[model samples]
Target chain A: MINTEPSRTRLPAVLATAKNSDGARDEPGEEIPQTISPIRTFLMGRSSGAGVDLLFYGVMVLCAVSIFVIVLAIIFVLFQNSALSRHQFGFTFFKGQDWDPVSGLFGAWPFIVGTLLSSLIALVIAVPLALGVAIFVTELCPKFLQGPISFLTELLAAIPSVVYGLWGIFVLVPLVRDHVGPFLLKYLGWTGLFGGLNIGVGLLTAGIILAIMILPVISSLTRDVMRAVPTSQREAVLALGATRWEMIRTGVLRNARIGIVGSIILGLGRALGETMAVTMLIGNRAEVPHSLFSPAHTLASVIANEFSEATGDLYLSSLIEIGLALFAVTIVVNAIARLLIWAVTRGAPARVA
Target chain B: MAIEPAGVSLPDNTPGPVPASEPKSTGPGRNRNVLRSVIDHSVTGLSILATVVVLAPLVAILGYLLFKGFSSLNFAFFTQAPRPVGEAGGGMANAIVGSGIVLAIASAIGIPVGIGAGVYLAEYGRNGVFANFVRFTADVLNGVPSIVMGIAAYSLIVVRQHHFSAMAGGIALAIMMVPTITRTTEEMLATVPGAVREAALGLGIPKWRTTISVALRTASPGIITGCMLAFSRVAGETAPLLFTAFGNQFWSVKLGQPIAALPLQIYIYAVSPYDEWHRLAWAGALVLIVLIMASVTLVRIFAGRGVLKGNS
Candidate 1:
């Protein structure tokens, strides 16, 4: 095969190198006159670098496949560690409501409800603002303001969750407890969502922080979705004598609505999985919060708050079970969001997601 | 019907070229125009308000951090060990050192593997089923949530060893970094024109060599940005380190032992009821945020310059 390379045979350097040592083949009619030199083979990777080529390709493929391996291993590890709870409670672990650690009765229903409630509140608060931000940045803002706003959005996304937690404790919890809670209680107390002791740290505060944390994610993806909307759509709407908002509503929003929903869903996944800030502000109670101000626990917050000190093997296993549930849920949510975003951005190769 | 001049209105909402059949002077038509313009202005106002509302928290967070962080960042804050409970005052020097170590280990393992995966996707596996599968799984891994990642590291390494180790924490962070870096690197490599790869191939370079020396070189800035983005993110994560690194009180850098981290330390401090620990928590958060913001800014600058250069 060394002398068989039609492309490299034309190169004088290759021809010269080929002549320096005999080919390795000893077939009856082959042109190889001598055995291959170990030094030449050592200096030049693989025979004609074919082995090296294969090696490089193999290494890269392995590296790429490592992602698959990591995910599978995580699933396996979660399942393996959570076996005690899996066998003990079986299906009832989900419906079990008593999370009293002292009694060792673990039910994920309250945490599930808490997580869903808080995340729903986050979506409610963030989606409209995120949509507005996306619209402003993409369609309404001055060209000069676009870059800074985008940068700021990225910065916001990069802000640490723990930092958000820190701020939540000192600033947001107090604000929510003192002013917002009281004001809402005074005016809209009949809604029942606001009915609580309102000591500040609760699901409502967690939801607010989560909303802030997720705002940039939704808005950024929404902006990308809108950007992927062809300019001709806008042009056609404007050519129809539509106002700017009318054009945006008819052309951009209509076209990118699925992707915008996908973006919101992605934000929801983030809000659901968000741990530190929620742990700090959600008051670390293992209860299904009836009101927004009531203390609550999320699957992730519970793991983060108690995983370090989960006393018994069963206790740890129960926590791992919650973690497994979180893992499964987030994976499903993210997969859905990715598919939806991909549907909208199919034509745009630059879609980062 | 009002004969108001449509030209008097803002050019944005003014009807461009009206058809003859659509009478502009009709009362309802003019009223509709007025209503449409009102809707336009209000939406515009609302969108701007949205921007302001979003910016308000960002400003408050940063501003508050600055105000509180500076006062708390004494000389001891950067150089001395944190004080024990019931002690007077101290700093988070151990955490700063510990963070550097963990992040270094994470980046070391993360960046190269991530870049390798990305290069494979960009250079070889364009539309292959396997490539798409890998990409999908990578994304799935990315969305697994940090707490789960913590749990994963705990079960995988901590349980096996029966103890916490910085190695486990580093591995957990590395795992988180991989998907982000891989995706970023892939996208950046994709942006490198086919012509460049073709040119390298035309010059008789090996496929692997061309991918490395040419395509990768061109995509370096974006790849760096991605790596930095991953770094900053994992650097600030606390949950994953809670049971992995396990947050040492005294300074420890051994791979098999628990180590302190800035975010983890900040977490421990933040939740503590002590006012002094709270101040230290603010200071730690300040440092973390500033570092993150600086890296993000640097990434934007580099990415912008690279993009402009590529276009030119």
Candidate 2:
């Protein structure tokens, strides 16, 4: 079947060449008899060049639609394999706290809560910093410094997540446990959120590392959005005798607010699904955290940490279900994000800048 | 002093010219303006500080990894499997070779199909309903967590085969690569001038031939870089391989057999309780970082030269 796809497209080109050969036979001194069969020539005549191109075009459309097929396959496999948990636990599977694999009890509540809380914390920490970086790079920094600084910021995204995990283990965890955690506990101890034992590796550490991991994505994307704002807007605001900040506030940022929000949501999507660094730093505890310093396990982290050790069919299915939930969350979040971005730039010329 | 108009307040300071204020009369208002300016300047300063603070980790990770891991990266580290537990001085040869093999298989699966889909998007299905669906699916696929992909691969390949294998691992990696390569290839192909297509079509060339031979050739460099970036990304992904490749202690090259990879080895070593393994993990990390950085740098160099023409 695959071989025929190419040959079908090739036949038209061959027929065109054969027609050219016939045309050559019509010229003076060209006495060669056409070797082409009449039936074959008739068939070729019936299928115009446009029809052959249309055939290939249809083939290419199938190729494009196959990408959608792959995505559906991913969703299908995840849902199909997790059927045991879906049947056994039902709705309670999402809400139950018990997750013992030995006794066959499984609950996704803690993992779900942990994933949300960590991603929330990551966004809280990342959004302000990323906005600042974007603002500075777009509106404040000297032209000479802008390119290098933006490049440096984006370099963070290129570093593998495992390397981030390594750095978290060696550098960030200790810094959090020794200093930042204790300080937050000491000062914000009145609030229950910060009132916990300051283990270096916990929800906060994971969240902070997630923030750092996603900083480049948010900042770069925001910069792209902010840069997309027409310069005329900035100049108009400035012409009204506004300060640089005021011009940026009233012009560039306001114009790009939807896109900026989309970028932040996109960052949130990434944080929700980040695995290696969060797994390494979150201490791999399957409990709902009482406070920022308490250890927790996100869905992605839990799956990464325990997929290999899960021996039973139910155990494996439960993990697959967690993956399904994670897949569902990220898909929903990213879809919304893309739509928000599309609203701002729809029908605009698609260009990298 | 000149009497002010009744109920008139002072005009707010603006960069444009304003009526001159009596110094003695507007002293308090002047103080408020000064404070506002001070706050604004400091806010800018803080934003700059925030940029620096966020950027520090990239430098720290690179510098620290180079400092800590560079020492352990000798000849032996590249040519041997990880030492068993406590006794020191081994390498990650199997994992390195396994990574190469897995990535090779992944590229083989991902590149042609991804570029074909991209060609469809750019050439045939531009703005069509099915094209939009494919584009959206690619976006969602890119955002799908690697661990979830691992789970999907586990269900799809491992369960059917009744065991983990390199083929499953490659499929997971290929799945991860597909969206990125497809999107970037579409972007690259979109950058190819329309005139090129018209030129090819005016010659009575089939649209498929024009897309494949003419347009694809023009966009090939960017697409190559996109595939490279995708390869570099999956090369360091550990989560998808956790259940798929499943790791090996010694050498294994069969496609159906389980294998080890650099990221998987690094994950195992980093999490293991032994100090020597941690040291080896550091070395492996340095090597992995180098591999990723090399590709990224190559992309950047190509990007700077306008080879991708900013379509990346």
Candidate 3:
């Protein structure tokens, strides 16, 4: 293979004449990263042989560039398909609450409201619980229990959304209807949020389900951020003779708060866009629920429930426009969360891998 | 502060940070010490309570699923299709097969593009603006709702082809899988030390060759687990498959034909007002969760191990 070489490059000389694995015996091309691959020697004279190398690089660049293209194409497709609704409904398409397709009136208001309220409820429940879980796993857990507990917490994120939906249908819905709902009704009815007749499936049910669904996302990211807090900070606080909780609150939580907020927002993004579980649990109504116990439809669930059978062009266009709005909102929210997380982590590779 | 002053005992229920200034009298100082311990212990209790609140639902759901689904599983549940309205015994065999096919196509498309993009981001996209653009886009894209992706697939392929097909469903799932795969791959690859790359370069190996054979091989385990993560996540997607695969009732394997998937079938059954279908949905869900949990368990183990440990 080396006989084909025209010029002398140090690589070719090292490859064709290098010692073998023992580092003492001489065998050409036997020392790989120690020497060069025999394949390199075979193409020595034809330096144009970089064609394969260049092609591989080009393909990778193309694939990377395709991510940009895919996002653009999605934005274009959503906007193009949503044109009719975007035009007829005008720029304020998200304003009104009416969605009567029989008369062709469509507005994103109710869906937006449902998405907001349910996600906000999820955030309200998830943030503290997730933070506690993160803190427990990161700071307070016993050495023997930490690994298993962390693994169990992350496993929550791995469960499918559809399965969560099924569980919500059978298990959660009954629990809410039989116990939690009546209890809230008897005790907290004056607040007006839990007063409606409980049918077992409603915004609050979906919210609770969503809280469970987003818990892993929030806690995992929060854990990573907290873990990213330099160990020195913890040591410094401890050196001051602070208690475990005091050290954690002062050294870890305070440092990790920004990223924790970021993680919560990311969880909120998941809750807002979650489909199957919410669809199964939220009752798929178009109305804005007067009480959290009442039924409602979210932007994502609305799309999932309606898009399949939407026949009229206007109806289809409106659905796509709703999807477009969801696409844009989630993207912006996620981008903001990413920025905040990036600010906290400062480009350090997150432990998500 | 363990300023426990072990002899001091105080019963205070005030909720605030420890006062900056102690009364300086040993009596007040000791009380303040007890106050600090009280606050510390209470915060620990709250956090533990938080952990319990989060985990209780998980245990309840998994336990109920086991109770309901295990009792319902039968031979027919794995080997047969849904027997029309009244018949008692049938399985999601077709949906299982369809899910396999769709996942194959998704893995075919998603893994390569995702890993290739990840390779670029880690190796070449270090400082460039375009790389940052790609990174930001990947994060945002990861957060894009699955239903929206379903609509995109419906518009791009289903509408154009004039039918729901497994291929369209596969494409939708593939798109969803990309951001995750890309991110995981990039992170895993980043953990491959640069000195290794420099060594390969020093040995006169081409940059691409060093990346593929050297870096990728070193990072393969993490990357493989990353792909599995994407696979398991996509396996349970119902929203993306709603209009794309469209959830067939009977067996259909052709790429062009609508196909059933485990998640989609479970969804259809769960929403239907039939006791029999409800049972099947439970069984199907049980199967899906079991399958997903197996892979998830792998991820949990690998992820918890801190894959880059000594390399970094």
User: Top model by lDDT, which number?
Assistant: 1
Model 3 lDDT per residue over A1-353, tens place: 58645334445545544433234434344334445544456546445437888899899999899888888888888999999998898877798788888898898899999999999989999988998998887777665666777877877887788888989988889989999999989898888788768999999999999999999999999988887776667667665667677778898889888898899888988988999999999998998779999899999999999888788998999999999999988988887887788888984433211
Residue lDDT tens for model 1, A1-353: 86668444344444444555454332334343244445445545633556677889999999998988999999999999999999999999999989988888989999999999999989999999999999988887766688899888777888899999999999999999999999999999988888969999998899999999999999999998988876667767777788888988998899999999999999999998999989999998988788989999999999998888889989999999999999999999998998999899998634321
List candidate 1 stretches off by more than 4 Å: A1-47, A349-353, B1-29, B299-312
Q: How well is each residue in B20-90 modelled by candidate 1, as lDDT tens digits?
A: 42665867887777778789889989999999999999999989999999988888888888888878678
- Kindly report which residue pairs in candidate 3 clash with one another: A243-B1
- For model 3, fnat equals 0.70
| Span of 10 residues, lowest total lDDT, candidate 1 chain A | A24-33
Residue A295, candidate 3: alpha-carbon lDDT: 92
How would the candidate models be sorted by DockQ, starting from the highest?
3, 1, 2
Q: Clashing residue pairs, candidate 1?
A: none
Candidate 2, residues B249-312: lDDT per residue as tens digits? 8899999999999999898888888888888889999998888888777876775565544343
- The digit string of per-residue lDDT tens for model 3 on B1-312 reads 121111011112222334444545569677778878898889889998998888888888888889889988888888998889888888989988999899999999999999999999999887699888898888877888999999988898998999999999999999888989899899989988999999887766788888988899788778888998899989988899998999899989999999989999999999889899999998998999988888777776775564564244
Model 2 stretches astray by more than 4 angstroms: A1-59, A347-353, B1-25, B299-312
TM-score of chain B of each: 0.89, 0.88, 0.86
What stretches of model 3 exceed 4 Å from their correct place? A1-48, A238-242, A347-353, B1-32, B297-312
